[model samples]
Target: MPHPNFILLYVDNPQQSAKFYAPLLDKQPMESSPGFVMFALDSGMMLGLWSKHTVEPAAPKIPLGGSGELAFAVADAAAVKALYAEWQQRGLQILQQPVSMDFGFTFTAVDPDGHRLRVFAPYDPAL
Candidate 1:
């Protein structure tokens, strides 16, 4: 049986996307070619950034608008807040500031291409 693997996103500019994503991901790409770069996340999931102009004809097109909102389970609310501030300082568009929710503390931000990312940490009842 074939195992499920990486999810690749098409980007008009791979280098710029890589720069924006590297810090958020907390790691640099393990392998990078002219058309692609892949970062291995802590969850063992691989995120790939592929050059839109160079990808194969069969490569799936990323949906326009906010169809996909990637949620990451972070360590704590403080970490989430720090990342939110960092991304904002970098001039990235923030959709929401960190807030307590039923499930956790969360925030949202949009990448260079308007891809939405929701970062969150489990809510602590004591806090």
Candidate 2:
């Protein structure tokens, strides 16, 4: 089976979404157009922003978030807290504050298009 290396998020405007993500991801789009934008992550994965109105197969009209989340794993709880503060300072809509969960120390924020962005430090029994 082929490994998955890409993720696409439907957005109202790919250009606008790119603007919102560029600073947060600290990367520029390797590919960009009116209806699509693509960013290359350090992990070799790719993130794509596709215009909801222009997707070929027609995406469902349901709400944008809550269906899933794009999660970023950090080294420790302190890192999660730092990122949470940074994102908050950048004006992201914070949905959850830093808290310990069964999985880790985490927080949730939303993009302008309502895509959930989760930052977490995986629970480490060794720590």
- How many clashing residue pairs appear in each of the predictions shown? 0, 0
Query: What TM-score does candidate 2 reach?
Result: 0.96
**What does candidate 1's lDDT look like per residue over 45-123, in tens digits?**
8999888888888546656533787788889988899888888888878888889989898999888877888999987
Model 2 Cα displacement at 91 (Å)?
A: 0.4
User: What TM-score against the true fold does each predicted structure earn?
Assistant: 0.79, 0.96
Instruction: Report the C-alpha lDDT of model 2 over 1-127, residue by residue, as the tens digit.
Output: 9999999999999999999999999999999999999999999999999999999999988776739899999999989989988998999999998999999999999999999999999998886
Worst 10 residues of 1 by lDDT: 58-67
Task: Report the Cα lDDT for residue 33, model 1.
Answer: 81
Q: State the local distance difference test value for candidate 2.
A: 0.94
The window of 10 residues in a row where model 2 has the poorest summed lDDT is 60-69
